[model samples]
Target: MAEIVELSEADQQRKDLILRNLQESLGVDKLTKQLSTGKNIHVYWGTATTGKPHVGYMVPMQKIADFLNAGIKVTILFADVHAFLDNLKSTFEMLEYRVEYYQRVIKALLSSLDVPIEKLSFQLGSSYQLSEAYTQDVLKLCGHISQRDALRAGAEVVKQVDSPLLSGLLYPLLQAIDEQYLKADGQFGGVDQRKIFILAEEQLPKIKLGKRWHLMNPMVPGLTGGKMSSSEIDSKIDLLDKPNVVSMKIDNSVCVRGNPEENGVLQFFRFVVFPIISPRIIDIKGQSYSNYDEIVESFEEKESISAEALKEFLKAFLIGILTKVQDKCENEELRNIMNHAYSSPPELDTSELSEGFQTVLELKDMGGDRMKEIKGDCELITSAKLYQKLNTDEPLKVLWRVSAKGKVNLGHLGGLLQLKRLQALKCECSILISDIGGFLDNGKCPWNALEARAKYYEEALKQFMKAISLENVPIRHSRENQYERDYTLEMYKMASKVTKDASAIVEGNTLATHLCPLYHALDVHFADVDLLITGEEQRPFVILGQQLCQGIGLPSQAALLFPKIPGMNGERMSSSNTEQHLDPLDTVKQINKKIGSSFCEPKNVKDNVALDLARLIIFPLHEGKEVVIKRDEKYGGNVSFSDYAALEASFAEEIIHPSDLKPFVTEQINALLEPIRTALTPQSKMITAAFPKVAKKK
Candidate 1:
């Protein structure tokens, strides 16, 4: 029995335009159904703004022209980002310039064929790729796929190397996301990107998006009769090439008789020349090719339609089409774009030097003994190998956390100073004020006052950052983003995996205290936090975060532990306990009074708040310099300790009295607080708003 499929006049035209010359098509029925319903299909063709457009690109250009002729809306996407993410072939710096070049050049290409530029629209990936909804989808996509799948999906398109960049895997995911985000009914790309297209087909539905059609054009051979590549100038002819140059390139191209399969000349006429030129006819060497098939037929036959005849015919046809393209590419704007887009990439310093010297040079400000103190209060680093943010200029995102249950204190201020130092080392740190967590901590942060308290903590930190010249550091209230689309989704995943373990470790029953670990862990994924700068007390959070790295599938965060800072009573500083620490916003008289009565035992230096003030507060603030203890001539007359160790040893052996140390450290501490004190004046209202005075009961 014979079966037939019927198509309306308009539907057949649209299908032919869309499917003609396509090497592969997915969801063809889905596309036909849309056409049957009188729906105008929107097909987007994206080109990564990486390299120049060549004669090989004409294959897709001819197809794009066909889409326009069929009355389909076409969006030419300048994928400005995919190139940067594709093994950094084009970096973020070159993205803007290349995008402009791609836009101009692609338009010129379509205009060269008179592809009806009116129906064609152009858009950039950056325009919508960074939106909140889109970013949530990206996060969702990350959770679905494994590292192996991501690697394989992009293996063909992303440049392969020994140690591939994470951005390379992200390249395909971003491209897959573009299919749904652009609202395209189908995507148009080369068959080379079939894996990524297939990835989109499977992953988009998981994210609640319908599977779209994929239109793939076959790979056309270059002038060398091999793959057309942007890197090899001789392999393809540039759109802007002069007639003589194009003729010369065409003349030298490989086109063997009866070998159209690998013949570049015959492929061009078959794919591009005949598709756009008209009448489906070409006269060559007393023979004619009314269609691409006739030329292929000639190639299969011996002693007919010689390679030179085909090359000569292709040369004239390309020359005619390139006249407008060359004219369009010669604009002043294009020249400027080319100059910037193709400029040399930044090079790394490669002068030969010893490894030890290189390490020292890389350390810069945080060199030698000072590096030990930078660990703050932590006894151990969880993942020592991942600690590369230090001493290097590579930018890494640092997740700096603080519980906004109480006012800012000197203990936290000292950590901020270290955070500022890391900022100098090129770490982009952001403060996550866990307001919602604080609210759940059995009224440590009252429900009614959560937002206010959060604002206060943020403002106080901002004032401190300004004093330390780190005013640009970002500060975010957790409650503001706790319920964010991706955050909440990942929070559930984190909650499922490790909530019991988090509950097992913590003594407290408060929701925030137990859930804090889970929230902190999930922040590594949602926030893309590369490093966690926290005191040793928060070790469990980092431990759980490492476990979640597998389930969430984002990069894990390395925790840098700072040794816990001692409070006035010689214990880990508590923001909730006013007696244990001095307020950063304290008055000079308050500061002096607090230090005068603080616990500083003579002949004992371990975890002593007073010595800590000297080591953490004074020395680091003074750029790791020596401290002088001011006193009378008989009382060791202005004794000096060259380092924190010397000072600690002297205090341990009773050489420096707590009495003398108190006044000297107090004076230095006040001096250190001066900038913050001054910056706090204008921002006083933030404190007033955040921590409003409570009414006392009679």
Candidate 2:
């Protein structure tokens, strides 16, 4: 048996630095005890061929290599099954190919680093014999937990009920069982998988296993922000990407000035590559030369650190990694075995020429015929690919066609139109009214058009209304108040207005009928409201909205209702309470209370209730426009007599009414306000005295 090797002073220093970097980057500690246990530590890593693996993979790959060098056996598992669960586009065959591809690449990467292949073993999860022990453990785990708890523990809440087959739910459990099968000391993944890892950890102890599973996660910055992903192309640099592509990607990567800590490229260097090289300074020097120009100068003078030189270095480094992987893939014997194993799946053999065989053959034939019959029933309407050229000279009349097979929905269509750079025309169809109008009239074009053939636009709208009503039915109403009825009536009124508008357009009697769906789609798609305030002529203009909400005492819940403009953070204003961390109504109340508390008290009568209200409500509502309220002390009342109505109408037309705040509106607003009301009792009392109260009936 191989004895664990002790590190030298220099090696120890490198190990410490690497572990520190990893711990900081991942916000987790390394398996220090595991490293010193004198046992072979193996790390197996593979990505399902969901397109190509990006730089996000580097974090785990580098960490695994670091652990391997620290005297542990590392087994890299290409989680082909997990990939199938995660990636919708990945087929079993494709997964097999991806596993092979990753195996080659991983091997090459190790070889280029001069890491020993003897200590590293790359294996496919699907190829590993399904351990009966693991299967029984999984069945036991399933039995121990309620279905709800199991679903919650598995992170299956976010997934739609029908989207995941039974296998998808079992995926996490299987992954947990993988630890038992592999006898892995630890597992590593992104922070998003924390729940899954925790489940595994919990389940392991119950199995009478004394060993605790270690989990290591690394921070991989995304293209826009937050966690990096293979899906977001700009967020990561692929190892296989060309030099120009890599340079452009890195150049465009988000960089923080005076804060090198979170810069994506710097983080990549610190976390992914720093621990591998013996001398840290040399690695730093290799990454960053004197300057781009100086590097160019050096390259011109001595062919060093030039763009070309760097490109060469990157290419060689990548190719060196890929070459070893490719060599492994070219291993005819292994390839043949994998091919045979995958092609001939170990399913029940019905080829014994028995009664069951005949029955299966007959069923297969019937199934084929039934599939053909179903295909015959379907009709192809249009063949317009998203982002492809349009033949219409009258501007693209993009309509929402609800085919069962169609991927693009009304929401998706709205998103697509927002990207088009064209003059949007009006529409004349009355049939296209609904939130579709809200999407269109918001300033882009009418992107929510019904297909000329589909007769379910109205029905779809009704269903949508029913869904919304059921989801957000009103409460907190006295029987006399008719609150629920009032809200329902208002919703119907809104729907009626939509129907009227759509009908008028459909009848071809209005200029609006010429409106294109593309423009409407853009309008709704980019409906986030941002406030632009111009200062003095010489001063730069200030852009504010959601950011200012917190400053003005807006509740966290309400503040979050306002969408974060792109580049604000990686996430949007999520309506999902779990994701947003607060209920929408609570958020609104928080904002209202915060603003009420922060309102500056002015000694002058001019800056009283009306003035303050204008500042607090009107200005913000008007997208930060300063407002003046006229009041007469003689009348003992205040009213806006200025062209404020017209200004507000225009503001509503330009901003408020067009903005899609509907999604963020909550039915429990009154309930949320109870706490705020209690907090502001004194203020409310004072304000009530200022405004005349209606006399009570006897």
Candidate topping lDDT = 1
Count residue pairs with overlapping backbones in model 2: 50
Q: Per-residue CA lDDT of candidate 2, range 1-698, in tens?
A: 43456655655654564364344222122344344443455443434444456656656766666666566566777776666555234446666666766666566556655667777776677664244344335544543333344455556222435333333455566666676667676666655666666767666565554344444556666645666766567787655565567666655665443344555544544455444442433322355543333333444455444333343443444445545544544557555644543353233222222111112122245434432332222221111111121222222322221121111111221111211111122211111222223212221112222221122223333233232221221111011121133222222122211212222222232222212222222221122211111111101001111111222222111000111211001222221122222222235555334233321223232222222233222333333344333234553333332334543443344332211111111212233334433443444333333222334758
State each model's CA lDDT, in order: 0.72, 0.38
lDDT of 1: 0.72
Residue 223 shift from truth in candidate 2, angstroms: 3.3
What's the TM-score of each model vs. the native?
0.58, 0.39
Error of 1 at 385 (Å): 20
Residue pairs with colliding backbones in model 1 are 280-290, 375-562, 376-562, 376-563, 377-562, 377-563, 377-564, 378-562, 378-563
Off by over 4 Å in 2: 1-20, 24-49, 129-132, 146-168, 256-262, 276-278, 282-698
Q: Cα deviation in Å at residue 332, candidate 1?
A: 3.4
- Give the C-alpha miss distance for residue 186 in model 1, angstroms: 1.3
